[model samples]
Target chain A: MLFSLDPRISRLELPESAPAPPDKAALDQFPTYEVFHQRKENTAYVYVGPVHAPEADVAFLFGKEQFSRRFPCTGMWVVPTEAIRVTEYGDDQQSVYDRLPLLPADVLAATDAAVTEAYDIFHLKKRGKAHTHVGQVQATSPEAALQAAKAAFGDQRPVVNVWVIRSTDLLRSDEADRDMWTTTPDKKYREAIAYKVQDRIDRFKQEG
Target chain B: MYGSASTHDIPTQATTGLENEDPILLAEFEARIARGEKIEPTDWMPQLYRKQLTRMIEQHAHSEIIGSLPEGTWITRAPGFRRKMAQMAKVQDEVGHAQLLYSAAETLGKTREQMLSDLINGKSKYSNVFNYPTPTWADSNVISWLIDAGAIVNQMANAKGSYGPYCRALDRICAEEAFHLKYGHDAVVHMATGTPIQRKMMQEALNRWWPAIMTFFGPSDKMSTHTEILMRWKVKMATNDACRQQFLDMYVPKILEIGLTLPDANLRKNEDGVWEFSEPDWEDFKRVINGDGPCNAERIAVRRAAEENGAWVRRAMQQPKAQYVRPLA
Candidate 1:
């Protein structure tokens, strides 16, 4: 809900003059604008939260007051929330998104013959971190998607590098193919299994 | 502290059902916690875990918003430009904390609207210290210094909690609150060491707030329970008494160094190294938390009014085509 306080108890009164137009009071509420913050000039803008404002300038000011006042933010961008298009992968839709890496021969043949479109892809790399995307915006892009990606998934956190590629160039492993990447028997190569520094140090102390 | 450290009295019967959960599932959950793994939004958890977390986080969210009211009054009447801007920024931070907390609690299934409605209707409680009046500029400074100090102690412990979202939010909040503590201490120091009139006002404010500040960590551990399970769950990170002691250990010397005296004559550190003081009036603590404090009605009334006044703004922004999706932290 946009508002949590009950509106029924409001004491606002209407005038007794001729009835007003239906949309007369409609302009009071502003559009919900998404805020992105750039922590440093070298970093990309990351999506922070949304602010309601009638115009871009007002939204920038509100964003500063709401999100940037105490935090160290090098820059900020505000765009209306509607400007962005999102494709969400939810729990119930697993069957559609979760496919195995090995596909039918026809599908593989079709993939090789397909034309590619430049697309900006974003990644949520870490938990509790806000840098949403990693790929650079392709110069040949739809006006709306590029702007949305820049505003919504632009550099807001420190990223070492950015890569530009066509949408068709990206390859994703299907959920059914999890074991292909994860079923390695080389447990000793993983840090959690490999690093026993504490154990080693204790053994050394005991030997000494 | 924007969030209350008050312990809700949980009945013994509440844990009876919790004991009957599938043992195998419970063991795995406990093992994850024991290994310091964070429980995420999609994680499997016991019903009691969700219930306790919701209540604690919801109450904390309420505390932040309600906590804004007392010091918010000083934004306009602040003596100078610096104080005015700083006070405004600080109060805004508290409200932002509320927004963050409400969103965190929403991950557990309770909607922000329901939490806020509970707050307005007096079904939920906030920090007891906020229920007292901020009658003077000095009073605001005292709250900033002492109450926020107490919050830092409590919240820092909670930052290490097993809940991923709550811990992440607390990490960010504690960083901001550290700045608030400095801001508060700076303001208090100026008053305490200033002119005679300023000194007196500061002293009186400190005196008035001491009792409430003492109660900020809630009653002593002897009177509270249902905490063993919470501690294991990493929900209640520290006992009310433990937090209070830590606050005293960190702050008492600083308070004295500023030439300010605590109101309680019995307040002192014993040979055992624990800070000792006259037990705060538990009766008053109970009364205040039960919505019978000096400014409870006024605080809620102001909040209600603000909500009413802003209803049009909220109404104007509603879009029929837009769908509400919780933000990923």
Candidate 2:
């Protein structure tokens, strides 16, 4: 029974073995797709749900297509799985997490303003080391970084938990693409959010 | 799990929990509910709270999914282009409602696929309303007006129900239900003034659905049932009778105003200013939930087909595409 995955269903017990993550052997063979969603305006990007694809471009296209097909969706981001420096359960390799806060010291000398930038989302909230401030300042200067983070985040919503990378590190949509980013209207009648059942109720009642 | 933080916490305590556990913790749990603190997910609760919620949420989810069928039938048959588009949009909203419901059930640790499979396999429960057939477009109006109205009132009561996520979902859902109600009312009004044939269809739809509509509120708050534990756990804010009565009181007059006779000969408004009605065949209610209703087989089959047919889509979404090979290789 669907509901009975109910611990009561009494499954055939298998012998206990050491718990381990799935073999990474299959990882290299699979195409990777990262998911990004836009819940509201000036809201940073969020991980609503995921879908997988092979190449970077294809992954974005698939993620955008599959996840936002149902309702009112504002934006989507799709990145190749490999393009992200994600950590797996059993890897010994240094992850994007391992590289936090340490831009090579001489590299700090290389950039005049990025280091001194007053707490961008990346500097304060460790999670969003990926994207930010829509297309604005890109957290370049300390004041600019703070302003960009503040500007992108309205009402202090943890709506988008992640933001990072030099604006140069990512590929994103431009203003002209806003019309394209809208949920392609397959059929607006199927758009539930657009209809108000109560209004009709009131109108009928008044007419009666 | 122990007691709740409501007046009903003790009363709604489950038989399963009562059968187990230390007497002292059970006592203390009861005491906690008597104080009226909001129950959080991490807080201790009876296994019954989880079970009842799962039952309610899964059944509710199933209802939304199956609820799509009645509207779905009319999506193609709707008389005009506007009605066609409206029904289509309404059916799609039901799908979204199902998503929200399934997610609520998941918070209790269940999965969507598991619930869908159970619904297909005959082990889960959905509302009794969907079991009866929708024989006409007028049935569509009655459903939106009366049927959806029943659901909206019930859902509105849940806005303050105990489970946080489910309650929150109900709040959002109730806000959207206005449009659904309006859609139904619009259909009813149109049918009321429509050709003789249309009026006859609407009246017939009401007659066919009247009893099933009453039963949809579920069994009365009877002895040996578990309303006590439900109320205590805050799983149900209003009693079954309370909800059903709310439906009749609010809708009976509306039904009459539309120039239709309710099939219930015994149904009438008492001088005390309450509508009195004949009791529904509880046996029929039992038979349906036990999987014996009119369309039980068909509903299950349709769900099974969706689960089976959508397999490739689920797989494709979960899997990566084939990797490209070097030309030399």
* Best of the candidates, lDDT: 1
lDDT of 1: 0.66
Candidate 1 residues A1-208, lDDT tens each? Answer: 1111223312332221222122213223345555666655467666566554656667777777666655556666665554443333222212211221334556545544654355644443333344344555433333333343445554433321122223443232234633433323432221122322334334433554
Give the per-residue lDDT of model 2 (tens digit) for B1-329. 00011111123333555667667766655555455433433345677777778777787877888888866877767898988877876777677677666656755755555676567667676777777777778887787778788888778777666665576456546655766777777678678756688888888888898888887676666544476566775677887677777878887777666567889888887898666789999887778767777776666655655555665655565445454221100
- The 10 consecutive residues of candidate 1 chain B with the worst lDDT sum are B320-329
Prediction 1 TM-score vs. true: 0.73
Candidate 1 Cα errors over 4 Å, as ranges: A1-36, A44-65, A74-132, A136-208, B7-13, B222-225
Proportion of true inter-chain contacts also present in candidate 2: 0.06
Q: Each candidate's lDDT (Cα)?
A: 0.66, 0.58
Instruction: Give the C-alpha miss distance for residue B233 in model 1, angstroms.
Output: 1.8
Per-residue lDDT of model 1, residues B70-122, tens digit only: 78878878889867877876787899888668767877877666676677777
What TM-score fits each model? Answer: 0.73, 0.65
Candidate 2 global lDDT:
0.58
Alpha-carbon deviation at B128 in model 1, angstroms:
1.0
Instruction: Give the CAPRI rating of model 1.
Output: incorrect
Model 2 scores a TM of 0.65
* Model 1, C-alpha of A111: deviation from truth (Å): 4.8
